[model samples]
Target chain A: MKRTQFSLGFIVRRSMVHRRVRSLAALLALTVSAAVATTLLTLYVSLNRQLHQQFRAFGANIVLTAPDGSTLPSETLATVRAIAGSESRIVPFAYAVAQTADGAPIVVAGTDFNAARAMDSWWQVSRWPNAAAATPGSPVAAMVGTRAQGFLHGDDFPLTYNGHTLALHTEATLRTGAAEDSRIFIPLAAFTAWTGQSASTLEIQAPGSAAQVEDLLHRLRAALPGVQVHAVRQLVESEGRIVDRTRSLMLSSLVLIALTVGICVLATLTASVLERRRDFAIMKALGSTQHQVALLFLLEAALLALAGAAAGYLLGSLCAFGIGAWNFHATIPPLWQAAPAVLLLNLFVALLAAGLPMRILRTMEPATLLRGE
Target chain B: MATILQSAVGSEALIHLHGLTREYASRAGAVRALDQVTLTIERGEWVAVMGPSGSGKSTLVNILGCLDQPTHGSVRIAGTDVHQLSRQELDRFRAETIGFIFQQFHLIPYLTALENILLAQYFHSMTDEDEARRALASVGLGDRATHLPSQLSGGEQQRVCIARALINQPPILLADEPTGNLDAANQEIVQEHLRTLHRAGHTIVMVTHDPEMASLADRTVELHHGRIAAERRADLTAQK
Candidate 1:
């Protein structure tokens, strides 16, 4: 007899349509699992970078100082500038003990106020001194730390050091929760003139991975011979440890969630296939090869997985955006790079869930099933 | 033993069974369903199998349909020893050689009448919608092609089952109480279609308890306690 071959798609469509409730139940389970997996994976990829960037706000990772009691050469700033290049913020400090009008001594530090502000952006200051007003050699401003303000009789005061005195205009009160809160900040050129000393230390804000930072430190040490360059352990190590722990937590949670979801899908698929055993038996009795029967089931699962994965990608992307916004106060765009991996993951899960059901189909006897035994 | 059974039947015989035995383990121990039963049917013959409920009528049909295997025996259909065929080959053999009509209709409830016939064709090789439609028309169900099994009457559903059975154009047809669930009127309608198929040179093995239905067959074989009790030629009975 001349027969027309019905496409496999046609059969699967009819089967799913006929058992709409069961198909939908399986599809929903797969969709939810896919969504959760995709969401976690996307967020992990997107948020890891953001977390590192947030840590960057903590402060400079590298600090450079002179060796022994000798101060860094006046030309050391130029050498550091040449090596650190334009991307790095370099602030050099020269410290001296100066006496107030009340004869009480106060520690005074000199630095490029603009660079200092940029390097320590987290510092709370009542007002920032205008770098334009300082000019080249002018001492138009000095910032009094909140603690040092109590030692000064007024906002504008004169400090004498080594018979040389400079009148400093108070532009702001710096309230950093550190040693900076107990010192005075003046222009480095003016302090050098008053104390006859150049910059003693350098604070550098350099951005990159730990390897890149170490490379920069090596370059700085080699370039400026006697200068001692060291990474600030509290800043660099803490940042590395926090980022590592967060990534590990996200990865572990992602794996755990995927496994839990996979098991749920497995249970749903098993029950769905069990309910269709009679149909499979009929197919077997009608002369369907085991391969053909198995193909039908696998094809059904693949279709459901493909559909669920697509919907999940969209849902998970939205979820990632919402979570990023809620916690980081930043919009995280969808990490499209994770799409392929998510698809592979969903396919693996769907197939794994179908494993037990396919085994059941293989071992089922048409005669026994048809007899309702 | 197989040679003896094969030769006992004429060269034109399409089915030959030798020492077929099927046993099931019960709480009371092994119980035989078909005890060393042997039978043969020629090409283009309609044979009625009749027996009490537990006399192994269904077992015989299931074995012939290749849906079950006998513990000990050889079943040859068209000179092919089905027992020796692998599982996959048996599926192919069943597809190409046999069509079955069950007592319960067994039409997938979600599918329409036309789709039910197409399903059989799909399993056989492929489905031709035109052929499926024609099969439905042949069974007087062309107008109700779109009706689901649940929406059809018992007679209509049985007719759909018959159409599905014949869709693959197999040489042999096995009907296990095809009208067992139908009213007398519906039974007559289904039997008429069976008569048409038999006249068209198709070999048919029908299991039924109705003598009137059995009277339509070329011969009737009666089984008792898993053994053949009697065999009679319907033509001889008509002649007497």
Candidate 2:
């Protein structure tokens, strides 16, 4: 009698297809693990970038202050700009203690209204002083802070600094909940005329890593000698610690999920293999070598793992997109770079699960099993 | 009431066993199944082994089929020492040289009858669908090729087992109570297939407790307490 030529692949496919329930059970288990691993890794990669952007909203990590009771040179803003490049926003401020009509001492700050607005967009203000209305040599338009607004009786007020009188028109009121809430804002040009002082401080919004910020500080100190240039440790350190801790937490979670999923896959595969013990025995009795039997099982597991990995990649990428959009208001593309790691993880889990069952199959006595024992 | 045929019927002894013994370790010391028993079966002979339960009939067949190893003895089938071969070598020897038919009809329940036959060919070498179909037809299962073992009756399942056993075209076929699970009608059907194989010069060794089935063999070896009690020609027994 002629025999049909059957390859290992055909038998494996037939066996898997024939036992649809068991195959689906194993496939579902593997897919869940792969999905979890893919999602965590994807989030881990994008979270760093997203977190950095979020921290950017908290304003600058570097601030340059003048020496006590002294003012920075008027040329300091230009020098800092030249050194820090165009990636930074530099807003220089000049201060003056002025007396109002009622003889109350008030702190008045002068700066480029547009630059200040851009640098501190998170500042809550009722309205911003009209930059177009406060040109040089015009009626000084002031954006009074909540505390300073209490001293003014109306929109028009007169402030005297060192017996030099200047009339101010209140344009808006600001409420920043910080010390900025007690000062009044006017154009830098106007402050220079009223107080005869140049800029005294520089508030810089710089975008970079901590090392990059340190490099900028070094360059700033070198470029502007005798000026106090330093990183605001509160902002810089908190940002660094938050990002690092979050990454560590994410990594640990990924490992824990992988271990849990691996165990689940192992349990499901073990049961599947155990259920097929009779089939294995029959094959052994039909003169199949232990190696051949083990290869068959491995092939089956590899097939399941590959399929699950592909499906999980798709599912996890969608999850990452959802999380990114919900939290960061941005769509994160699929991290294809993680595909290899995901595949290896899934394969490792599958092969690890198959190890015990293959050993059991190898040592099984064909004669005893075939006798229905 | 007996005729002793030559053990070495041809140029060489087809199956030669010398002091074959198999022992199992139990809680109550060792249990000897086949103790220093030696036997030979020549080519183109249909020999039936008759014994009660726990008489080592299955153990002897297992050793002969290379499915088991003897604790202390040598088994040579067709001049190849079964006990001396490696695990892999014994697997090939079994695939190429021996065919086993069990009373339970151990066909893979998930596979069709035709696929079951092809499984044997896959283990032996490559599968030939035409050859598998012919094997099925020869066993009167040509129309039931696509039926799974579970879908078939007990007798039909046993026929599939027979087809699978002979698919590799081995010289030796071992049947351990091939018809032990069937009724009279199915038993006759299975016995007819066995007779056809025997006529085609197959070396058949069967284990059966039915004297009627034993009488149909060319020779019968009765075992009493793990030793051969009688070896005689089946024709002489029918004559008696």
Candidate 3:
């Protein structure tokens, strides 16, 4: 019994030494699925972080807008700002539409640029527009998005707006999420002067994590009457839901693939066990206990599973990472977090798949098993 | 005439089976592979079981080697009742008490002779590479230690199997048709080596259909329909 205690080294050697192909196949199946799971999970977490950062840079946690010409009362504005200040960063902007001298329609935003700068999560600036006056035709400058600048090709010069022609210079472009790509920014004075309107839309940033952003919006509504506000929660919810569905579909596909691999492993192992029945019988006849035979088979399985999992993980990850960078044109995280999980899961799967063959070991009657019936 | 019991207790007798029976159920029907049979093999005694196909010679050898269990009787080897032992205990007993040789040579194809021999020791010890090498040398395969089973001739492959069986220095060796797959010259060469092993005081039990091969052993037992048909002693032949 002591000699037959089933040492780890013995199991490993017997598995690899006796049945190389079946062991390798099983291990490969497990490793591949592990890598897939790891890579997908890592990408999901990282994407959420990236999206949240971009939304934060929009200069407020929440935004409230009213249709044209209904100015918010000064006291209502003061009360709204006060309630938001407890756990949020609040900013007010007057939103309207205007036309360039060439009759191109544009969105006009009038705001306190300094306060907006402090509240926005993601804004890059070469310089903030000056509040001081400029010539009648040439007003204080504004920042425009990359897509908005796309409309003003480099060759187009001395842009005109509102019946007055002024020099439109391209400053550094600030990016928002995909939805915000077409927006343009201008100084409040310039916008109010051109549009001849004096009403405001409120953008509020609630304190705490992104999850709490929604609660802040609800609280803001209860505090302020007749004011409508839009929170980043709307954006986050829709995006998160889409990501969840995608992850579910991807996981289901992986499971199916894993099942196929499991079958391959099972077939290989079962064949291996049948082929070696004589060997097992000989050993048993020579004094190998049933447990020792079982150990030998189990050890063989573990070795195969480990090898297959490692190879599959490496191969799958390489493909996934490559596609994310080249085809999708996105930065994929390094994905080291998935390695251990993949390895463990692969081992488990290999063991599970090897269960059928283990039964073959138990039923092996040494005298008969060796007879080649 | 000496009964099987008296000869079993002599300094030579290492295994004794009493009223042994083995039954098996296959798709065809229930079959009795071994009938009520009493036999004894002395320590260091080289013996052969000879009969036609399906005559239970292989079954008798399997019972002697502990690779099988008799359904109806007791099997005692080295003073231990084999039938009383658990499955794991039986494996340990086999590892410690017996070695086995086969007609096909059963050497793992991918492994070199050295690795193949070392395989037998795996279940018994943690590490014994040098011992395995020494065992291979005992069978005159030291030069061919690194050769795969495919690379070796039939005789050399059988030598590797012999080396593997001898690695543990067990008291009993069971060979099932060790030369059944060998060419005549290789068979003679293997037969010579087995004689040398017997001269060195290792107990060997072989099962074969060849009367010529059976002639080389110290004793021959003939089985027919799962029962002993005849038993002969080499000493008696020498005396005549």
Candidate 4:
């Protein structure tokens, strides 16, 4: 017999089809493992950046506050920008207690409405107050928080601070679902003019790694002397803790599921090999070496694993998308880099699971094995 | 006296076994399967092995087929000490030398008839589909090449098994109760194929209890326990 162009692939492929039930069971095991692995890994890797962005949306992680009863220098925002770069959103804020017409005091916040809109993206606003839209010397435009809207109404209202009165008209209604909901916002120019106070705080969104953020913090402290530069450790710590816990949860889940799939595949493949003992015996009797027979089985497993990994990667990406939307109201992009790693992992799992059956196959004596039949 | 094939006892003898013993170890201690059994068969001779259950007939054939090794003594086939070769070398030796047919027909149920024959060729050397089809055709199953073992009748399946066994063209053919699982008509069909193979000058070793089947062989050796008890030449029995 001439050794023509023979294909082990055909044998492996046809054999998988022949034993459809066992092959499907093994495939299901590998597919589930890969899917879960892809989902958790995608979430874990994406969430590190995602959670950081979420925390930023929650508010700033770095706040610049002037110490004592003083106020920040006029050059503080410029200095912070020079250090933090254009990527950072620096919104300087000032606050004063002002009395309404009925004598009730409400907290009025002075901020750059443009910068605030960029920094506090989570705020749901009815509309933003455009300074250009207001005519010169007309009533000042104020964006009122939803909670503060009840106190000051009728489109325009008067508030007196330190014997100076400013008439403000509602330009927008802001709802932040947080402390910002209980205050009122007016342009820094109008507030500084009415209250005779400079900007006192700057909420900074520094986008970078922890090391980069620390470097930025160090530069901020060095640049502004007598100015208090502090990180909003609450937000930073919460972000860190949430990300850490989420990663731990993902790692444990991936491990548990991997172990479970490994065991299930082990059992499934073992049973498949056991059921085919006769076939193996016949092969051996027909002059197939132990190595050859084992190779055939492992090839089948690898084929199953590779296929399962591809299918699982696709399904898992969709699952991650669904989970991201359900939990974060966001879309999680597929991590393409994880594809090769996932393929290798499933192959390792399948080959490892098949090891036991091959061992059994090695110990088998074709004559003794086929004796019962 | 146990009779041997007089015409085959020359340089043409293809199998030589001397004091071949096979033992099985169990909790009940070791049990001897083939005790000091010496046998020889020349090339192109048909020999039948006859015995009751547990009489070591299968064991003898298994050792002869190189599926089992002897605990003592040796088997030399085609001028090579089968046991002296390494495990891997012995596998190759078996592939080039022996073909086995079992009573159950032992066809890989998943493979089609053509594929079953191709499997043997695959393990031995190369798989030739045309050659495999022709081998199937020789056994009167050429049209059923695409049929699975489950789809074939008992006799047809046996023919496919025989084609698979011969596809590699091994010098020796080993059959263990080849007709044991077949109906009367199927048995006759299988027997006729065996007779055709015998006439084609292929060496055949068949294990059977049917006297009529044994009479088809050149000689029949009856086994008792682990030892040969009686032998008869078909030519001599015909003379009687």
Candidate 5:
């Protein structure tokens, strides 16, 4: 059937004007819900991404520190490597106290840099150093982690070697745990020549699975009763617990806000639909099919949603930017990153609240409404 | 002398109903508005329903217009059972077969005369700007096409309402107290328009309390307590 666009236009206009206050109230409720929901969802997604990136920067799958000046045995390292769940990169080394010509002191250590690289996926490498030398006279190069670099004042530092001072090159920064950056790395040959140590402490990373690393640590600790073993599993688990709690609180707060806004929107839309029931009935009695009536309600909802979304998107982005700038001293995510997500969320809220009025649309009786019954 | 061959042939019936009963529920009790009322209204016949108040005149008009359903009988307009049709189909049937003119001139206040006329075509046909214009012009409100309901005088507003009713070109026109709310001068104008519509071969059924209004019809049906109490032909009323 042919429809007069103008006639329908007048119907909508009359309906809106008939109860101006109610219409305004509904629009306001929908707009507020959209803004709050968009802001919270955007923050949640961005924060999760940032946290994941930070976690990836720490290279070690598992690091075990042995105390009391004891070196980890080769048998323990071999058993860890042979464990079904373990990865191939496991290195052990020892450390000793040494002094420079100026009588300043340092702890010289042995490490395997190649294997360490595989464990820390988010390591932002400025440069990769040449392989460590095989003999005593070979100079060692070390990459400082962020925390260690901070401790060392962002420059090369001197270490004592055989009563002489050797200046080590700080080739790059590894942003891992706080302590990994501060230590000095030398070839095992150089460490043995300098301190006469036979074996080294273990830095094990069974990257394939956490269980294998725990198993390896367990067996070693049992064999050498006097040796102390420290793995970061406890720290990671504790941090995970704290992060989970924070996430729960954030989610609950957001959900509460969304629910409150949703109810307000629902109330407004219900009132609007009730106030305009006569207009809808007249349209139907005039000859608008059920589909047409449904579309009319849908169109109204869409118009309201479009207005609310446009306003909310602008408000949400501004809020995100302001908070990021004032609190984090960084630019918020680009529009490309945040806008699509917010738009999708806004549309979802619109359709959900709109569903309520559409249900009411289904129950409208045209004859009764026209008769003013 | 054999001049009987010049006599008129009987007119065709446009609306037919059989054993129609319409009951309404009120706080007092169930009341029969149209009680087993069988009726046949001919095409091009301007009939008036006349009776005192609560005589079921409005109820019969409502039933004939397909605005209300009969509880015990069927209504057939143009050979279609209105009672058996779906709600949407019944609405379409009413729009296509009947045009109603009410005493209130129930023009949507916000709409202009032209827009009000266009609203009649909203659910039926596509845009009929020319038809709406012509309908208003036929009712002598062509110059007041853009005026709102409030802007038009009582007679002009009633004329716009008539134009809207005729825009669909239905076979029957149902008017409920078309001049009940009009002043004497406006009533004369509205009644003249109704006569003009009848003269143009439109079937009209009107409900009014005024005996003078009833005298204008080609036939009058007197209703009482939900029953047809009397029927009068225009020729007999005219000869008196």
Candidate 6:
């Protein structure tokens, strides 16, 4: 006499329970839609961070130098360092041509060894030669280029620069897929003392968004009027383009998958409703209003949407983590922003499918439908 | 039976119809499913409607049960002009004033037998599990309360249907070919239940092709081509 179950909810649960196969079909479609959406959306946000780090690894994006190959004032290095952000590393390079023992000319560059090594991550070195503690004619540890082995001839060689002969002891062989592979690297202090010259070029690894980097370049150029400042436009432009294109591609793919899943769910729900015409007719014959019958199907659809989206969000988060590991070599956290969109998309699809049957419910005659026709 | 007839609350004509007409659109112009029919049914009366196939018996039942609307007519049931009520009011009126029993039983396949009875109660007002169980026990289905329609035999399913229809204690029962799908023994069982309902003073409107089933009613009306062709009462039979 007291306890009574809310009948609409009861009907929804019983009807869905009875139609497990169809319910699962629709739920599966929704789950996959949410998962794919999550994967793409999570990746979309994280791709920019990952790609920026990758490009920074590839080397410097901004370069500063003097015009006509003239060396800048020694104070200019300090000036440029002050203007550049702390996250950036500015390495100075001084170049000189020294003749080997065989009288062959080889280019040499001197810079902060550690900063250069940190910025040029692609360079492979067997060992970094020690350039400390040396006399005028005494042998000094040198990093020999792989190509200069022919003329430089062994671990020990003699080089003459400005009529002064210096003995070189090779401690490392360097290989870079650039001109650096044919040159030698030494400590900037050592080269400056040996050649009596200051740095003529500065390589700046500015790690930030393209606009931020571009803004930095403009400030550096404006601050140093005599110095030539330019961005490595290839890397900067391509990085921007790649990130934009990747985001666009992910959005496009999510849209396509959502459409496909929506159509599939529509088909599944439509078939489910058609198959249960007898049930609807019986409910109507029992004096159920058209709105009540419609509520049953709508409630079932809403429940399926909620459950599928929740499960899918969890599944999609796992999938996004997997994609981050495989593609970006990083751990990407789930993007919570996609939860509402996924739920709404599934609801829209479910409602579209369920709403079609509501129209059919209005036109149906219980007597004709119950006649087993 | 006469003593039980006094159980009716009042005899102000439980159902009244005038110029009842229903038409359907067909490839060959309008098809009149029911044409110019006039009838009345009193509370506690058992009336059987006999007709051939396509004789509009289902159309009349559909109209009486408020499952469909007549093309041109007035239908007053339980002292309310049903045609004048809104769609929602009609549904409530139907649920409160009439119950349906189909030949196919038309029990929802997924619901248990007791749950089937509870469905009617749920639609009408509230679902009482205790009362639903009692309804099942009254129909000799106490042990079969948990059985789905698919698991129950034809006779058990029909009993579930009767329990479902009468759960709300409606004054009128519209049964269309109630035993058309049952074997002879099951038919007898179902017909005896109808007799008990009739003796209990529940007005019954039954459509059947079997004369034996029709003979159980106090009066029988014959329909032909959507018109009342003949009528017969228990005491005297008339052709017109």
Q: Listing every candidate in turn, what is its Cα RMSD in Å to the true structure after a full C-alpha superposition?
A: 4.6, 5.1, 7.2, 4.5, 8.9, 4.4
Per-residue accuracy of model 4 over A249-319 as CA lDDT, tens digit each: 88888788777876777777677777778888898888988789888888888888998999999998989
Q: Give me the displacement of residue A370 in model 3, in angstroms.
A: 2.3
Instruction: Give me the displacement of residue A349 in model 2, in angstroms.
Output: 1.9
Q: Candidate 1 lDDT, tens digit per residue, A14-129?
A: 88898899899888888888789878988898766677567666778888999875689878888888888887778888888899888888999988888888878888988888
Docking class of 1: acceptable
Which parts of model 3 are misplaced by more than 4 Å?
A1-24, A43-62, A66-92, A95-185, A192-199, A203-213, A222-227, A230-260, A269-275, A282-296, A319-329, A334-336, B1-13, B125-134, B235-240
Q: Score the docking of each candidate (DockQ).
A: 0.47, 0.49, 0.34, 0.49, 0.21, 0.59
- DockQ rank, highest first? 6, 4, 2, 1, 3, 5
Relative to the unseen true structure, what is the C-alpha lDDT of residue B116 in candidate 1, on a scale of 0 to 100? 80
**Per TM-score, what order, best first?**
4, 6, 2, 1, 3, 5
Chain B TM-score per candidate, please. 0.93, 0.93, 0.89, 0.92, 0.90, 0.94
lDDT of 5 at B234: 90
Candidate 6 residue lDDT tens string, A79-112: 8778886778788898889888778898887787
Q: Per-residue alpha-carbon lDDT of model 5 for A249-347, expressed as tens digits?
A: 769978998788777776667666655566665554454566666666666666677677677767776776776677545566635555565556555
**2 or 5, which is superior by lDDT?**
2
Expressed as tens digits, the lDDT of each residue in B1-240 for candidate 2 is: 001112223337688889988888899999888888878888888999988998889988888987777889899887777666778877887887888898989898768999999988888788889989999998899999999898999999999999999988888899999999999999999999999999998999999988888888998887767777778796574321
Put down candidate 4 lDDT per residue, B1-240, tens digits, no spaces. Answer: 001222223455699899989999989999998899988887899999998988999998898888888899988787677787777887777787789999888888878898888889988887888898789989888899889899999888888889889988877899999988888998898889889889988999999988889989998888888888877788755321
- Whole-model Cα lDDT per candidate? 0.84, 0.85, 0.68, 0.84, 0.67, 0.83
Q: Give me the overall lDDT of model 6.
A: 0.83
Model 1 bad stretches (over 4 Å): A1-5, A43-51, A68-104, A108-122, A126-143, A153-172, A186-199, A205-216, A328-333, B1-11, B25-31, B209-212, B223-225, B232-240
TM-score of chain A of 1: 0.80
**Which predicted model would earn the best DockQ?**
6
What TM-score goes with each of the models? Answer: 0.85, 0.85, 0.74, 0.89, 0.65, 0.88
Q: What DockQ does candidate 1 have relative to the true complex? A: 0.47
lDDT of 3 by residue, A1-373 (tens): 2233334465457546555565455555455565665556555545545444444554555777664568666676677767666545666677655555456666656676666777763565556555564456643466666566666656233434555554455444556655335555666666666656555777765544445666667776787657776766665565556555755776777667656655665565566666767666655654556777666666666766667657766765676677567744556655676677666776676566456666766665677677776
